[model samples]
Target chain A: MNEHTPTPTEALPGAGNGLPSYLEQSPAVRERFAQLQQRKVILEVRDLQKRYKSLQGETEALRNINFQVHRREFVCVIGPSGCGKSTLIRILAGLEKHTAGDVLLDGQPVTGPGRDRGMVFQGYSLFPWLTVKRNVMFGPLMNGHSRDSAEREARLWLDMVNLGKFADAYPHQLSGGMRQRVAIARALVNEPRILLMDEPFGALDAQTRAKMQRHLLKIWRNLDITVLFITHDLDEAIYLADRILVLKANPGEVQEVIEVPVPRPRSPEQFSTPEFRATKARLEALIHPPEAQGEEEAEGEDALPEKIIRFTNVGDNVE
Target chain B: MNIRILLTYLSRPSRYRGAVFTLGAFLLPVLLWCAVSYVPFIWHPMVKVENPGGVDYFTPGMLVDRSEFQDQMKEMRQAGKPLPVGVRANPIYLPAPHEVARALYTAFTTAPEQRDAPWLHQSLWHSIQVIFWGFVLSSVVGVPLGVLCGTYVTLSRLSEPFVEFFRYLPAPAFGALAVAVLGIYDGPKIAIIFIGTFFQQVLVIANTTRKLDTTILEAARTLGTRGWRLITHVVVPGILPDLYRDQRILLGWAWTYLIVAELIGTSSGITWFITQQARYQHFENVYAAIIIIGVIGFGSDLLFERIGRRLFPWDRTQERKSA
Candidate 1:
């Protein structure tokens, strides 16, 4: 699985043209990458497996899932639908039990949901009854922080998410993107060692989703926390992740881990770069194989059982 | 308010218009009752005797059937005696609107003819206590049980089937047993109300609890919340608004059973006042007592609605639609 081309370290066409080259990392970024490689591993999963049983029979949802996230690393897991990405993130958050595996955070075995790991789901999970400030304060207060301290912490995180002005607003009053931002603030206020996000911006519109991506990247860069993000969008994975963990469907297992060739301080301008396109193409191929593509095309044809039965011929002359 | 706006289908009008419509709701019914009572040609089936001249059985202020009054007047006329005089009026049971309105004020001040009987206010107070205790007790026991049933599938499976079955049986069916066990006093009356509301309350509250978004619970768990704190902080507050609504509806249900419940005991509440006035043929007082019960029930519902708005300011779904 590691047979993919080595990380592109050589200079490309735009190197001497007074334009940033896609195949090269800046000296400072290279130095940071070197430091990050040496940083202690914050989370580790080994030979993880999950099985769901019903009266029909037992089915494997995930198998042999092995990965490690270094401290302060931004790792995105990209896979097709039904690839158990949500299940994997839930297990890491300790909200779900794996059939067999060891999940460790800071070298401590994760037994159940604890303050060490914070989670943000794809859906709007903010408590509707709580104001933005109180929603952020929930984690701290539950872990025994005094109300004053919790409120102080909540205010800081809310301000970080650019939602300090809406601290008193209820969840229903906010837009989808704003709600997700508050959710992120709520998760971060716990000061968790790692953050697990399962398609947190999937429900937003294209424009809002893009904005939230940049917002999250900024937050991740400033904070000293590791992130394991799950998404199906290749562009999103390439845009946000330092490394992308691509998984193959039917009982999901890791296919490869690609080091994002694009450099740090990622911007929307970099989306057209050769490196970003290359990585996205690779993910697309891994998720939708050539052999499966043929079968899917045939199935698509079969799905439309009957020809169109148009009663109106008004557009026939135009066509 | 314009009639066009008021008549618009499925459209909420302005607040002033809404108030006007509510007043109209009360006035429409009262106007129909007044038309039937005061209009001389509008089926006044009886005659109220003003001067009972030459009629052996007719007494002043007595209401006699119109047909019977006519036959007596004809007999008097044929005998050349001064004809009996009367005016069109509704039957004794259907008191005129003015008489009932007067009784509304006079019923409270009038002493009970029987020295041992309680006054109208005392009867009303006693009935209110029965309703309060019965409903409060039901909520205290049922709310927690319902929340538990909704939270855990095992508990729900164990209890909901029986609750569903029991709620179907009329609450008054337990009157005899309650009287035997709790004695012929407020205890039995309260028990009947409890029986009426408890089973229904558990089912309603359980359904409300189930409607609480599961994603919020999952989010709470991820935030290091565990065990009973999940219930107290997350589940309870999450369903409080819906639960409050369920209680309001259940309180109304409790009131529906009050008359039956009061009848089960020694008859010491507003029901007693109604029955006593009815026996004495003071129909105006009976109507007054019934209307007072309606006012109390509707007024309390309105008060609860106002309090609920204040308690859960964040819940805007219950807010009245704007124009």
Candidate 2:
């Protein structure tokens, strides 16, 4: 296979290189990388395990998951469906309990959901009854901030998401993309230490999704908060993350954490870069191994057996 | 009205068209009633006696079957006496629209023949109060219990089965018991209304509460909301519009039990007025009172729906459907 298609287990052709080529290409990128490495870890997940017990039996959803998100870093977790990406993010958010693990935020043990961790779900979760501004104010007000101060903070966050004009608009009035922006504002108004997003852009159309990715990256660039985004879209994970935490399915576990070689201050034009293609190829190999691909192809041929009964005279459309 | 617009299936008409249809809905029935009442050949099976000449049993203003009146006239003519005079009329029970319309006004103005009997408005007011207190009390308990039940599985398991079972037992069955325990007064009447609506309110509200998106609650939790704050800030507001609609429907259900409830104790309320007027064979007044009950029920529902739109301007589901 070409250097772009290195197997999951094999090191890249330039593995021995002291520094990734993209870092060497720009002094600003090198400096940013150094600063990122020096930043203290804001979120740490150690030996996280989750088991769901039902009448049928116990099913391990996630096991031995371990990762650390440095302050202000953008980390994306990508995996196939049912790979426990959502479970992982939920555990981090304290929305779901893990059977065994220590999720530490700034070295404080995370228990249940708290303002320290904010979450945005894929589904439009805005309170249908509240205006965009009120939805954003919910957190601060709930946490004992007076209505005036909460409103001020909510407006600031709404403006940050470029939805200042829509503060009075209801969720139903806004498009799907706009609703998610409001949701992000709602989450950010509390100024959480870490933002956990579970496929927050999964529901958007391709154009909207790309636009939101840019919007989110801009916000992340300007804010001091760290992000832990979960997505199955490989391109989305590569486009936004400082580092990509890959997971394999079944009893989901960490596959490999790839340091995105694409330089910081990223842009859409860099999508076709050799570094970007290299990282994407590595992810593809890890997620869809040759063995599985061959098996799927074999199954595709015989998965549909010859029908025993024909209800229509319509011949097979495919030649 | 455009027939093409009216006949379109599963499509909402324009606002003007909808208003016209609504008016027609009301006008059509009243028009049909007028046609039956005024058209002599349509269904006037009886005749009102104008004069009782040579007929010992016939009296002026009395209604006799058309065939019987004819036979009497034939007999009277054969005897060579002045024939009875009559005009086609409907059965007395089926009062004309004009009479009922007159009763709508006069029923309030007409004083009770017996001293100390409550006026029509007073009876209506009492019925309204019974409905109000009954529904209010049911909602006061039902809304919270239902919200809690929907939020917590333990509470749901503890209460839902019993609520489901109790709702199946007809509320009227508790009427005699309520009267026995509370008293033969407004207490039992109110209790009957309470029993009629409370169980259903709890279940319906619980279902509505369940329909609230769980993701919103989860989002609230991550925002540091917990304990009673979750219920007050998240659960309640999240389900308020749906709860408002459920309460409206439950209020209607409470109205359905009003007559049965009033009959349980000492006869009172509009139900009492209706029975009293019926006993005097003032069928027009009875019809007027019944229409008033319907008008009150339907009018209150419209008022509630309007208030709901104001209270939840953010809820566009209703607006979308109507539009």
Most TM-score-accurate candidate = 2
Q: Residues A74-144, candidate 1, lDDT per residue (tens digit)?
A: 99999988888998999998888999989988889898988889999999999989999999999999999
The TM-score values for the models, in the order shown, are: 0.88, 0.89
TM-score of chain A of each: 0.89, 0.88
What RMSD does model 2 have?
Answer: 5.4
Off by over 4 Å in 2: A1-35, A297-319, B1-13, B51-55, B66-85
Candidate DockQ scores, in order: 0.43, 0.50
In candidate 2, which residue pairs get closer than 3 Å at backbone N, Cα or C atoms, i.e. clash? none
| Predictions in order: lDDT | 0.88, 0.88
Docking category for candidate 2?
medium
lDDT of 2 by residue, A202-255 (tens): 999999999999999999989988999999999999899988888888799988
Predicted structure 2, TM vs. truth: 0.89
* Separate clash counts for every candidate: 0, 0
Per prediction, fnat is: 0.80, 0.95
